[model samples]
Target: MTLAASDRGVVEPSGLMAHYEPRRPVDLGATLGHHRRGAGDPCFAVEGGSFWLTLRTVAGTATLRLSPTPSGVRAEAWGDGAGEALHSVPELLGEGDDWSELDVSAHPLLSDSAHRNPGLRLSRTGRVLDALAPAVIEQRITSVEAFRAWRVLVARHGEEAPGPGPARLRVSPTAAAWKRIPSWEWHRAGVDPGRAATVIRAAGVAAGLERTAVASRGGTDVWRRLRSVVGVGEWTAAETAQRAHGDPDAVSFGDYHLASTVGWALCGEPVDDDALAELLEPWRGQRQRVVRLVLASGFRPPRRGPRMTIQDHRTY
Candidate 1:
């Protein structure tokens, strides 16, 4: 890969460029931004009119920059895995996502959301371990806690991305690197022992998990494989499957807020997981799509209680 320095003193890579025009309308940011651990995620960024992502691909670590164009999305990749990164752009941008199964006409809110955001589509990252690690960290914790732990750990342990992209951007640690993270580091990052153990266990068997993602048909196998990890469960597996394989039916069944969110939006009251399941029965094959549409509809359930307090494991 070729490198160049901008007059502003930031190094940037002038690497291979590729463009993909999706058959359906695509919202570049909404589709890819789902992978971001948080707004301040070290591995994902939005700067200078482009989206930058750093990930470990089959070939190696790569930094990818995506910019929206009139017709589609344009991409530039750097590092040993540049070609593979560029090649994965279409899938990353939801080129294979088919929205035909979503029956929005079942509700006016769903119909309106579908009409308003025709460009919204589910993205497939195809890196199961990368997706699973964060999901494990997020298990049973508030998103604020989970995102913070992910950011702190990745920034400290991950390698700097190979590109003239953002200086602070880093790819997630490799499976071995993840396994090597000491227990103290997890505590320092505000991660509890259970979540930490789960992540390490998943890393130890990363290859099998990734294979399950590849071998998955409609996401069942991937769900089973992910849940096989001790700390992983229905919610965590669904979260991983949604990103790693673009499984449209991967509803987060055990999420603290999801059932209430769906219940309030669809039933005019809060509901538990059972009620949420019953309400979503009409869209069995595409429950996640319905969830996404509900989220995009901007109907957050009213705060019925105090927000979850952030837990700091370092004190323990």
Candidate 2:
């Protein structure tokens, strides 16, 4: 995977180590659980690359180090914002953030989740729009399918991360780059043409969409504005909020499985969206964060129904 970087650099596989503890910035549960979902963790899959990062929740600190090789960015993070800077690359990829100023406890959702994953916290700071385009494309699909398609699409069209190694180092493509993707390529990534069109349309207005998330009022305003795009909806916006804005209230309401997951885990019966929302309401503004805690606590409902089927649009 050829990586693209604003800076020229590289890394030799054997040379890599770093520590991190992003102050009230990282969603640590996402880092440890989401399998490349969180930016704090190194994208160490590329050959000839190594990484190290640590979390210190009580202190609100993170550190970072990036060793650029001929191929990609070899990174190490330690201190208060190390993990933050690394995971925050999406900002550089057309996502933006003013992380220096944020208040964690000011939001009830964050205050509680910080207790849940003390080392990880999401302030009113982050790039909410970066995830919107791809996440909108992921609507109604199984996560396995969504991630697979995302990985494939990104690997194929995105440029490499600028650093060092023979590894595939690519950052997510710019808005212009994504808009230029061919129809056949989207099909190969298991994406339908309809979703592809939505993503392409979104990419064209990517900067404007991102701006909506950080506007003065609240995350809701951003959510409302993004849905103005043809293919975007509550579910898609919810997914984006979880990653982009760190919105605690952005519960994934229309999910086919989440209601069941929450019901079985907490109430032991499959509930509908209303029921799940009722159960989660006490957490209100931080509903998403509470859900994250519930998920992270390692509680899963006992298997009952048929498993979700995986569909590959490429074969058609």
Candidate 3:
């Protein structure tokens, strides 16, 4: 469905409005999953069924408010980049996602999930830098630790979102801004050197990285380019691809808990990466989608031990 742009002098002062009609119901939760950093993410806010996102665009920082309408989703924006943000709203809402060939009829578990969440769509931000920074911070760390680091770093460096929105709505730092972050600040945010260096290197090539969002490049090529960076690897590339391109096949191989979780969900027993890969081989290009289904299947591995201990790198 094509996005319709209109100048509506309604609730928003900017009068900038855009809307899209989806072929199927749009699941706002699944589409906006990548935007929320944590319960306290300063860059994103959701209240009263309206979703707000602050992003840095080529034009400038823009804050977008998305609300559901009877037909589809409506978007309003305020800031210098309002037009750019509105232009990209369709992609962000998964307009380009096509899963028509996926056949889950034979697999009871996946078929059940597909039936349960028919509106689920993989969202694409088309902004690699935004996804990469958080993925880098999450490397080899607990989610709590990574979230804390993200909150601290973004709050310190990100700019306030334009308009009369909540004070907590802020735009993530530009790639240049990220590259300029000092070692001391990284330390303060509890980000280790390796991850910090990776982010910095990525920032240096931010423009090039954005090209990976092009659909024609394919997720494999994007993964290869992302992994060419010093500290980025299979896991980081997959995580980035999933968000930036809505890549269905980008399964995070080296994630600390994913293999076991997927294994148990699919086979009723914890399995290593190899086993998980073998089990998911049938879905090849749709592996990530299968993983998402498993996660949403309400099937979890039996907890036999304590959770991974949270480590505080700030003290180091």
**Backbone clashes, each candidate:** 3, 52, 0
How far residue 306's Cα lies from its native spot in candidate 2, in Å, is 0.9
TM-score of each: 0.93, 0.68, 0.93
Preferred candidate (lDDT higher): 2 or 3: 3
Runs of candidate 1 exceeding 4 Å displacement: 1-15, 215-218
List the pairs of residues colliding in candidate 3: none
TM-score of 1: 0.93
Candidate 3: where are CA atoms >4 Å away?
Answer: 1-15
- Worst ten-residue run, lDDT, model 1? 2-11
lDDT of 2 by residue, 1-316 (tens): 2222222211111112422222133433243233243332122232223332222222233332334343333445444444454553322222222222333454454445445654333333244434665676577778777777777776776654433432443445567778999999889878899899988888888777767654332366777777878888788877776655656567888987889987776667889999998987766666765676666556678788798788878887
lDDT of 1 at 51: 95
Per-candidate local distance difference test: 0.83, 0.56, 0.82
**lDDT for 82 (candidate 1):** 87
Native RMSD of candidate 1 (Å):
6.2
